[model samples]
Target: MTSDSMLREVHVRDAIGLVLAHDLTQILPGTFKGRLFKKGHIIREQDMERLLDIGKEHIYILSLEDGYIHEDEAAIRMAEALRGENLSLTETHEGKVSLISDIHGLVKVNREFVDAANAIEQVVVSTLLNNSVVQSKGAVVGTRVIPLVVKEQTVCQIEQLALQLKQQAEREAGPITVKPFLPMKVGLITTGSEVYNGRITDKFGPIVMDKITAFGSTVIEQRLAPDDRDQIVAEIQYFAELGVDMILLTGGMSVDPDDRTPGAIKQAGADIVSYGTPMLPGSMLLMAYLPVGDRRVPVLGLPGCVMHDPYTSFDVLLPRICAGETIERSDITAMGYGGLYRC
Candidate 1:
């Protein structure tokens, strides 16, 4: 296709390959183009039809990062090429700032910073990096910044910054509000003969339960799949059919000969979100999301520590998932310091 005037468009299709801005003409006129287009740019419908003539081919656009090959889509479908933690940021006229608090040292510094700023609006804060007390007003808002730090609350702070910007925009634009998506509903699937047959007291179930609940969700369904792969897969599928937004499979996450959760998950037609988070005690964890009709239900394969430990890698992530926050590999990668690194 050829045109006299220059235009730019992003094309998205399912086929996975690498292409360039210039090569897209095979799909559409070179005039349809992008400015400052980079990897992971999302493409919309008009661009799709105009580019690949999507109806005629099996190609489906995944992301913008794939040269002109894949573009970003809002369906919450992340492409394999998308990397790092987006962490979700929003912008006002004020510059981007991270809130670090609850620790005595930075809280004072943060308070001073907020108080001094003339046009500041939102703050991203993580409290208690140290065992110090903050003497300032516990909560600050408006020209004030709320002391948003809580134990392992770094993700919460990041989320608040994103929301604060959105809220401020709504307030200024006119009254508009909508509920953020509810945390993904997760069903806990613990696989072990001991737990399933009642040989042991089912100690691990409680731990998984507590952790799930802490992340702003209730374990609406819980079950034991035993050591059988078929049973485990079936239970997971049953939960999927039940409409649980996520499924958590505890125990039997290891490479032991008896471990069947991983194999069962693969057989279940579920795509892996991630397996083996780098954090300890939960290293064997597995995360996958599968579609039930149109919505995705994430299933988690949590290892042992989700019970005994106060926090693990899952603790850092589950809330983001439960909050309907997308877990890009980068989000998990940022926890390298165990949420100790601020923002």
Candidate 2:
């Protein structure tokens, strides 16, 4: 159980040296080959004269010149061995909760409590990273040892809390059923003469489709419409009749004279909630709700950037929308991470 005992059990060869170098290309892909202490671990990039290494680009050199193994460095090596099995914490998961009042029914409440806790913890973490502080009374869910009055917390601390909670829960109870969330049906409206007329390929449709898939939702209907306002308006009404849950209008969202997507959306009798987002590359994103009888069909007009970049204000906001998120203008205006646009 001791650190020293565990390291010895790993039997990482005690190659006493200023630097212990290991060619990872020669080692297994994801095997945590024990704790490597003695520094001076050098990496000979790719033994290029040999077979081409897939995906390996850079080399890591672990040096012991500083002397003594930092507890963190030693621990990271061991953690590598427990890769996929690690279920770090989350603030929201698609787990169901049955109240204690229904305890007589066939359900376990404790497991759901743990899941809910994890979700809260993750949200707390997300807030912390953005420099926002949570009050003691506002501790995140599933946070072990909550009542956390800590002033500053790192990502690792958040991850550790999640891991510990998972281990403790697994010991105390049997696994509750983890249900897959019901996928919402989505409809895509691609608007642009260039794309629709083959002046340029329609890359925007696939990008939106991928987002739908990532959310575990289905793009039940997809249509390519030119910058013609009438076509856009007619199709929106047509899909409304088709009983679609959500509609996405891409391109032709800008303020250009040719941008008819927004006008057509309005003509569909859909109430525009927000005409544009404040985020760059996604400034033209629009959100609206079309009242279809008893239900409100959520509609989003994505910016042109969503086609080329994978992550944008749209990407972050879309999931929250799918989760039935309530949004204020302030929420949409806060996404200013110029460098956070990841694909």
Candidate 3:
């Protein structure tokens, strides 16, 4: 709490040449709502009527003693302490600073560090969910303090916590980092006899191509294979021989007798990570890794829902894979939470 002796209150008419101690917000129903006077703004003789119209009959001027810090300064310090690679900070505004991404990539948030920092009195740090996808210049985190001014020790405690976490992680970067996506060469195989026999036009090609290109990767080659496991396995090996970074097998992911994509993937010498995910609209998704000449290429058996659904397990895992993250069984199992999607 701020002591009364630290603030001098005077009528707006008599406050000319004095600095504003805090931001003054003006609300006009639905028309306008924002800071009409920012902290540190010098009072002008011409501004008296406007301030009065906003119901500001008096204003406070702060006289800070030692060991105290203004909210804007505190927020700036917090942002500096939490900023990591591929992130930029916005200028402090209304005692808040935003962390922006410098590239399109995966957002990795250190929840433990964030929680520890927020435990300090008057300190606030809000971030996007862990493993979220972010585009360039998108705001991922915001930092601020609750009061107009706070004890310098509060800010110091937050900084110290951040430093300790970074040291324990053996990295100089802060809690939030954006890992840039790598440009990969992907091979796509569309299974099912109907599409291979030309009984129906192939629909998975365009959709899969769009998803691949969106992540800065290209489908170098695409092949259509029937329900024969041997032919599907041959195509997988061919792509691996080409040294593509990833192989995508679409269609035939279910457990029906004719759906041979899962067995075909395993037959191609792939180490299956997870045969199915717990996520809705994509529960039959399969994840695997194919070793080729000291490199482990990612293999994904995408379900049919990926064709029309706006988001699915494929959406959740694709970004992480493009960011060079290895998908594990635990990662697939964790998708059960917040994975249900309805049309």
Q: What is the C-alpha lDDT of each candidate?
A: 0.50, 0.53, 0.92
Residue 139 of model 3 has an lDDT of 97
- Weakest 10 consecutive residues, lDDT, candidate 3? 1-10
Best by lDDT: 3
How should the candidates be ordered by lDDT, best one leading?
3, 2, 1
User: Residue 288 in model 1: shift from native, Å?
Assistant: 1.4
TM-score computed on alpha carbons, candidate 3: 0.91
Instruction: Encode model 2's per-residue lDDT on 245-273: one tens digit a residue.
Output: 78988888888999998888888888877
lDDT by residue (tens digit), candidate 3, 1-343: 5835678998888889887898899999989999998986789999988898899998898767799887888998999899999999998888899999999989999999898888888789999999999999999999999987789999999889889988999999998999999999999999999999999998888998998899999999999999999999999999999989999999999889999999999999999999988989888899999989899999999999999888999999999999999999999999999989953
Against the correct fold, how does model 2 do in TM-score? Answer: 0.50
Model 3 residue 109 distance off true place after TM-score fit, in angstroms:
0.1
Candidate 1 local accuracy as lDDT? 0.50
Q: Give the alpha carbon lDDT tens digit for every residue of 1-343 in model 1.
A: 1111212332245423432222222323555434332323244444545545523343222223221111111101111011112111121112112221121111111233222232233323222322122222232112112221112232233334444543664532111111122545667788898888988867777887776665457889778879999999999888888888788888888889998998898789888867777666567677777778887677777777777777776766665565465566665554555543211
In model 3, the Cα lDDT at residue 203 comes to 86
